[model samples]
Target: MAEIIGVIEQLWRYPVKSTGGERLDSVEVDERGLAGDRLYAVRDSAGKLGSGKNTRRFRRMDGLLRLSSRLGHRLDGPELFDPLGRPVADPTAFLRAYLQRPDVALAREDAVSHFDQLPVSVLTTATLDWVRGAAPAAVVDVRRFRPNILLRTPPGTPPFVEDGWFGREGGGGARLAFVRASERCAMTTVAQPGLPHAPEILKAIIQAHEGRLDALAEVVTPGRLSVGDELSLN
Candidate 1:
C-alpha cells in the first residue's frame, strides 16, 4: 500500500551545470532525470568541467552561479544569459573574458556526466524551515540547494523528514527512489542574483546534519511531473 506524503511545490531545471536554473510549472523526467537538466557545462582546455569545487573531474570556476541558462528553441543546446537576463551572443568568448580563463569554453556533456552525484535532488519545506531556524540571519532560498523537486509536506512535519524516505519509490506521474542525503558545499553560500553570499548557511547545515541537507534520488520511471502533484511512498 502506498501512503500520501506531500505535493510537488516547485520544480527546477538546470540547462547548464553550476549555473542558475529556471523554474517550471511542469517537467519531463527521463532515465537521466530532468530532460534538459545539466545538458551543457563549462569545460576547460584540460578537459575538466567547471564547478564550485576542484576535483579530478571538476575545476573550481568562480562566477558560474552568476550566469543562467535556458533551453533554446533551435534545439542546438542551451543558451547562456548574463546575470541581468541578457542573452550571451558568444558564450565561449563571454565566459573566457568574464572568467579571465582564455582556455575555458562551454561544451555539452558527452561520455562524462555533468552531474556532481545523483541525477535528481529532492528537498522539503520542513527542511528549509529547519535551516532558517539554525541560521536565523541567512537566506534559506531553495536556489541555494539546487534541488530538482521541492516537496511541500503537510503542516507540523519535522525537519529532515525526507531522510526516512531513502530507498523508497514514490511520485505521482513519475517514479523516483531516494538514494542518499545530499551533501552541502560552498556553492550553497555563493551569491547569485537575488541571493546573498552567506557562508553561515553551509555552516549551519554542517553542524546540524553533518553537511547533508536534502535527498538525492534516481528516476525509476520516466513521465511528466507538475506542481501540486501528490507524492506517495511505496
Candidate 2:
C-alpha cells in the first residue's frame, strides 16, 4: 500500500527555462501539468522546440532565461509578471538582454515564450532526501530539475516512485497523479547558481544510484493548489 508522507513544502513555476523561478503560495494545474509552467517556449525559425541537447550550436539556448506568470480565469490567459518582469512580444531581444547575447536576440517567433508542457512539475520530499543521500555534492535546488511542484513523499524512497500514484487523497483535495518517470537530459548536468560542479555531481549520483538524481510527477487533474494545503493518501 502507498502512504501519504507530507504535504508539498515548496511550489515553483518557471515561466522560462534556465531563468530563476518563483515560489508559489498556491498554483493551478491543468490537463498539461502546472499552470504557467511551460505555457510558452522559444522555438527556432524552423519550428523545432529547443532542448538542452546539442549545446555546441545553440549555446545561447542553454543559458538561463527569465519569465513571469499571471493567473487568468482561463487557460489562454494573461501571465503575471515576476519581480524581474515579463518578456513582451520579442523574446529573443529579452533573451539577448537577459543573457547578454547580442547576436542571438529575437531569434525566433516565440523566442521568449513558455513551452507547451504541463505548467507544473511536481517532486516529493522523499525524492529529495534520497538524492541528497546519494549525491552529497549536489546542491539540490529546484532549478536543477525545473520542476513546478516540490512535493513531499514518504521517507527513504527513491525519486520517481510517485510515477504510480493516482486518484484523490483521503482528505479532499484533488490529486495530480504520477504518470511516468521524467526522462532527464544533459540540462540536469549544467552548472548553475548554487551549484558549480553540477555535472560532475549528477554524473556521480547517476552512477551510484540508478539514472538521474531526481524525479518528476505530472498533475492528472486540473485545479488550484496552495502551499499550506494538507495532503494525505489512503
State which candidate has the highest lDDT.
1
> Root-mean-square deviation of each candidate, in angstroms?
1.1, 5.3
RMSD to native, candidate 1: 1.1
Cα-based lDDT for every prediction: 0.91, 0.53
Candidate 2: worst 10 consecutive residues by lDDT? 105-114
What value does the lDDT take at residue 83 in candidate 2?
Answer: 30
Candidate 1 backbone collisions, by pair: none
Candidate 1 lDDT, tens digit per residue, 1-234?
999889999999999899999888988889999988998999999899999999999999999999999884333788899989899999999999999999998898899999999999989999998988888898779999999999999999999998999979988899998889988899999999998999999998898889997889899999999999999999
Provide the lDDT at 175 for model 1: 94
TM-score of 2: 0.68
The number of residue pairs in model 2 that clash at the backbone is 23
